[model samples]
Target: MSEADFIARLRGIATDPAARGLADDVAVWEGLVLTHDMIVEGIHFLPDEAPQDVAWKLVAVNLSDLAAKGAAPLGVLVGYSLGDAAWDKAFADGLDTALRRFGLLLLGGDTVRVPAGAPRSFGLTAIGRAPEGGAPARSGARPGDQIWVTGTIGNAGVGLAMRLGEIEPNETCLAAYRRPQPQLTFGQAVVPHVHAMMDVSDGLLIDAQRMAEASGCRFGLMLEAVPLSAALLAVRPDVVDTRLAAATAGDDYQLLFAADPAKAPMIREIADGLDVPVTVVGHAGVGEGVVLTHKAQRVPLPERLGFMH
Candidate 1:
């Protein structure tokens, strides 16, 4: 079954308040926020990618979910697939470094050897302490709320293209893809002001559609307002197609949130204080799904919104 279909089927068995109807990524139970993410060779990462970067990606992606819930990471449980001895050793070292960098503990986990020549895969389950007031939910968005996104969009996707030799290499894009930084601190600080929040993993457009659907609202996005970093613009032009491509590229771990229009000044202040750039890309309206506009002209939805399993 498709990812959505599988999740839909599993929802029947996950009928608990903490499950949040399986509409949100993380499960909030008691005072803990929990999330699990997996990265596979040839899919989430290139087969020839460095073991250390792969390890970092595995941990960072899971933490990104916790960050969306405005939680402070506590620890992680790693599931490893045994492969080459040297590679495994490097991955372990990388994992140790990542955990230390994030101030997280290596709780415990399992290890198993995969079949010979099988693709390597790794899984991490991250646990975090939820924010004091309660974690924000993707389904909490309401009509008239302003939509905001942390950091620039499409850098990671562009980075992937660079790795594939599809574009010229740039340090900014390369680092973004190799080591995605989750907005943990910002998420925690902005939780109280946001009506809804989620990390942009699969792609801005797809994730936005998910939030809109879960909240039973419409997202009216302005392509021109979708923030693009100077590094990205230096490589690509400032045009509708470029914006669309960025919007659809996945692997961006930045946070996308909704808040009251009146919270704009406060949001800006929080972002300024944290030294993180945030942009107002859209607004929630009384409708459903997502609508796009570029230079005040309607734009058709792209056939492939983002990566899907």
Candidate 2:
């Protein structure tokens, strides 16, 4: 089937009340909203990547955004570029697995084909509802708040490196890169106590800068305090600076949040209950820029802390 034909078939199956027939306007809502992203072969994923992994990643990335806002996944609309029948079946199988695992339903979407020799692309639009009270915003953090991260950092980036054969793909490293488990439960647990929150798609340094900019506060990150997975250390034993670099590399789907220091014990308890480690990496200040301190000495911040357009 051609891309347009696929889309027409998908349109016939779509049932999202918020989509309004996919007329192409930005979706707006009071307690919920819609967001979409597109990933292209040779751009988002390597041409030879597995169909299952690609499908999983497409859904997981969108869920990461919803989790950052403390929202629940409602459903998703998918747009796939037409491929051969065998490839399409594999993609669908992968999508189904991810959707079932994440409690997300495939509402409906279009599929089409690009011109020959053009890069193949896939798009997904996710609809999510905010928490009962309200979703956490990137703008709500305040000075005097403690910044915390859920789980270890750098796993996904390390995994990607291994996948590219930059390093050996030991079990640890491979787990980090592929099949990143989004901190959905942890995000929900921290929502009530957190003043601001976001998933660590980009490196912590960059994402922290974003929170600071959005909330009009300064962030002080303690370099020694950033958490690293056992996998990262296993791969690069003597690299003292690996953690710092990981803080700027994209693709870790953990949550970075700010909460009152007084709530630390409770937050830790919550993390323990969820079996996810929570680490206090820094504090938010009244200043304007993000600062990194190593043993009380200020370190030079990276020019680009994370992903940049």
Candidate 3:
């Protein structure tokens, strides 16, 4: 079955309100926010990548979920697939550095040895203290709310291309592909002002469509309004195709949110105070799914929206 199909089936068993009908990135219960993410060799990361970077990616991705929910991380339980002794040690060192950097605890976990030569895989469950107002849900977006995204889109996708030697290498793109920084502080600060929020992991377009669907509204996105970094523009021309490619490229762990237009000044103020760049990419409407436009002209949806499992 497809990922959506699998989730639909599992929803029956995950009836708790915290499950968010299996429609959200994290589960919130009591006063805590919980999320789990797994990465695998050759899929989530290049096989030749360093163990340290891999470990960091594993941790950052899970925390990205908490960041979307405006949660302050508490700790993590690791699910490790044992591999070479030296590699495992390096991963542990990297994990220690990441946990220290984020002020998170290494609670406890299990380790396993997979079959010989199997791809290395790791999982992490991150627990965090929910924001005082409560964690935001993807289903909370409302019509007339403006859609905002943190940071630029498609840099990580470009980074992946750079890693594969398809494009010239640049530190900006390379680092983005290797190490994605979750917008935790921004997510937390902006939560009270946002009507809905989520981290863009799968692609901007696909994730936006999900938020729109969950919230029972339509998202009208302006292609030109989708932010592109100077580093990305240095390599590719400013064109619709480039914008579309960036919109559909996954692995951008930036926050995407919706808020009242009246909250624009406050949102901008928060972003300015944090020195983080944010852009108004779209607005919620009284329909379903996502609609795109460029230079005021309608654009058909791309056949492939983003990464799908």
Model 2 lDDT at residue 176: 57
User: Which model scores highest in lDDT?
Assistant: 3
For model 2, how does the per-residue alpha-carbon lDDT over 158-240 read when each residue is reduced to its tens digit?
88888899988888767656676778777776788889888888789988988888789999999878888777888865343
TM-score for each prediction? Answer: 0.99, 0.88, 0.99
In candidate 3, what are the lDDT values of residues 49-85, reduced to their tens digit? 8888898899899999999999999999999999999
In order, what lDDT does every prediction score?
Answer: 0.93, 0.81, 0.94
Q: lDDT by residue for model 1 over 1-309, one digit each (tens)?
A: 887788889998899999898878899999999998888898899998888888889999999999899999999999999999999999998898789889999999999999999999888999999999999999999999999999999999899999999999899999999999999999999999999999999999999999999999999999999999888998999999899999999899999999999999999999999999999999999999899999789999898887775
Q: Candidate 1, clashing residue pairs?
A: none
Clashing pairs in 3: none
Error of 2 at 208 (Å): 0.6
Q: Which scores better on TM-score, 2 or 3?
A: 3
Off by more than 4 A, model 2: 1-28, 238-240
